[model samples]
Target: MANQREELDGSLSVDDPILSLRNASVTFDEGNSFVLNDVSLDLGRGEILGIVGESGSGKSMLAEAMLDAIPDPGVLQGEIIYRPDSDTDIDILELNKNELRSMRWEQISMVFQGAMSSFNPTMKVGAHFRETIQAHDADVKAGMSRAREALADVYLDPERVLDSYPHELSGGMQQRALIALSIVLEPDILVMDEPTAALDLLMQRSILLLLEDLKEKYDLTMVFITHDLPLVAALADRMAIMYAFDLVEAGPTDEIIDHAAHPYTRALLNSTPNLDAPLEEMRPIAGQSPAPINVPSGCSYHPRCPLADEQCRSVDPHFHDTGEAHGTACFHWQQARDDIELNYKASVSANPNTPARGDD
Candidate 1:
């Protein structure tokens, strides 16, 4: 079935996609549950692409598949082609254990969520730092001196943080350490899964600024995974909105935020608080997200979509190019484009007093 779908769409060309997922599908059991369904995406160098969706939208799962970090008993069918800094492209899913091991920290790095769980309680923060750096460059000295420098790079004091354990450091400090560790190897691309989720507002801003600085200094391409639309708006050059394991909308960040094409994207933006405006101006999207295991037929967001009609309930929609660098997967993309203002006004009207949710 996957092959047939691929044949119909024609395989995504290798030259155009730096990292592409073409007709990708992942099923937990034999036709019992499909986590991902024929999803495709293209990422390029020097670009920061943000993937925004609710908890069960498979955002993290997609990240895992991209890195080939899925455990046994999981089946992934797709082409996750990685174009390294050396100008070599390899299908991550097809790579053997040794090959995968070789690429793990050297070519790509991931800053996963839950900083506490990610670190080893038994190991000192400095030791973990040295170990990670040594894994990539064994010749490089893995001494306290180097580890201290690394700690300082992430705004941590060498003397204090280097000797401290993961549990000893504050949540923000630990997250910064993880960020520091991820870049220690200087991987070409960094996949950050909610890098600021555990941080305070001030720390989140600081971390994002640090990321911007690192990107300029190291020439790194980043994939920032988060559900926060405002954060994406502020940081991402481009953005993709995921719904039920598939991309619902994608475009330049400015265009998507200002003129969202998909209902889900608009709903997401609607849910975000507008600090500059009065509380009465804020609005939240109505209804709950569909269950991934039993995603709604046709449009996955139709159940929660205000404009959903009979057609939306029966027929699935493919991504259609609405403008240059902007696309949406909705049958009413064109109509929605015309009616965006009206829809937004109506949404705001329904929930007149809901203030925009503030950043944590």
Candidate 2:
């Protein structure tokens, strides 16, 4: 396999998105269930696009769809176009097996959850790194020297990790090793699914910082998949919120965190724990997510949305842009916008002992 020669041209405006998903939908069980429903999003070059949602919200499924790793039984529809630094865009979903094989580690790479499982327990860490790099670039130097450098990039002691098996490394070390492996081929896009989920708070922060550094160093466009709103807020340039297999909101991270337009988005922001705030202040969204097989009609979120009304129960909301680079799928976005402050106030009122709204 050969790495595509399309390097970052640095010509496209920073405002121009490098990746786009248009009206994307994924279905399973012979179309009886829509795992992803008309979801669309964009990721600009060198920007981190964070995808946040609760468990069972189809966040991982969407990531798998992007990587074309959806199982055989599932069906995917819609376009995922990737533009490599202003060269012609390629439809990721349309690529055949051979094309996908070539593109996976060279053009785009994935850092799956459970980094330990991603590596072979029987193989030395160095061997795995060498194989991964060689798979994309056979001409790459296949020696201990290069492998050591790869380990060092993630702050791991090169010699110690090089000789250790996956089972021998600590959890944090394994995670960092996997991250190094993901970037070994230097793909233009790195799709990380909960890259720091398995680590402790300090380790998680460190990993995130490393990701930020690497992104700047290599100009990598990243897709950070997670349910943690605070982490997303800290690292991402933009964010897309998913619920019931559909994209409910997306926009610049700062805007999404401070001025979310979607009810679900607002709920997520409210649910996040504010360290400075009292325990009573952190109220997670109520009710379990609807099953994909039996999703609610009109809007999947209507059943759980506090702001849901007759219109929300009867009419499916379109993913409409709110004219500030923020888009939300809600029939009552305008009304919700007007009511956000009141809703937050009510939440705060319910827990008077909590810290002030802007305390953080």
lDDT of each: 0.73, 0.75
**Considering summed lDDT, which 10 consecutive residues are worst modelled in model 2?**
1-10
| Cand. 2 Cα-lDDT | 0.75
RMSD of each: 5.2, 7.6
Candidate 2 residue 355 C-alpha distance from true site, Å:
24
Error of 1 at 13 (Å): 9.7
Indicate the residue-level lDDT of 88 in model 2.
85
lDDT of 2 by residue, 1-360 (tens): 011112221211135778776666778889888888766666788888889999889888888877788887989887888888687889998889889988887788899989888999889987887777666655546544656666777788887887889888878888888888877776899999998788776677677777877898767989999988776677887788888887778777767766788888877767877554566776678888988888887777888887898888877776666756777778888777777542333222122231111100
TM-score of decoy 2: 0.87
Candidate 1 deviant stretches above 4 angstroms = 1-17, 85-87, 134-137, 140-148, 338-360
* Candidate 2 Cα outliers beyond 4 Å, as residue runs: 1-15, 140-146, 337-360
* Residue 194 error, candidate 2, Å: 0.8
Could you tell me how far off, in angstroms, the CA of residue 158 lies in candidate 1 after the best superposition? 2.7
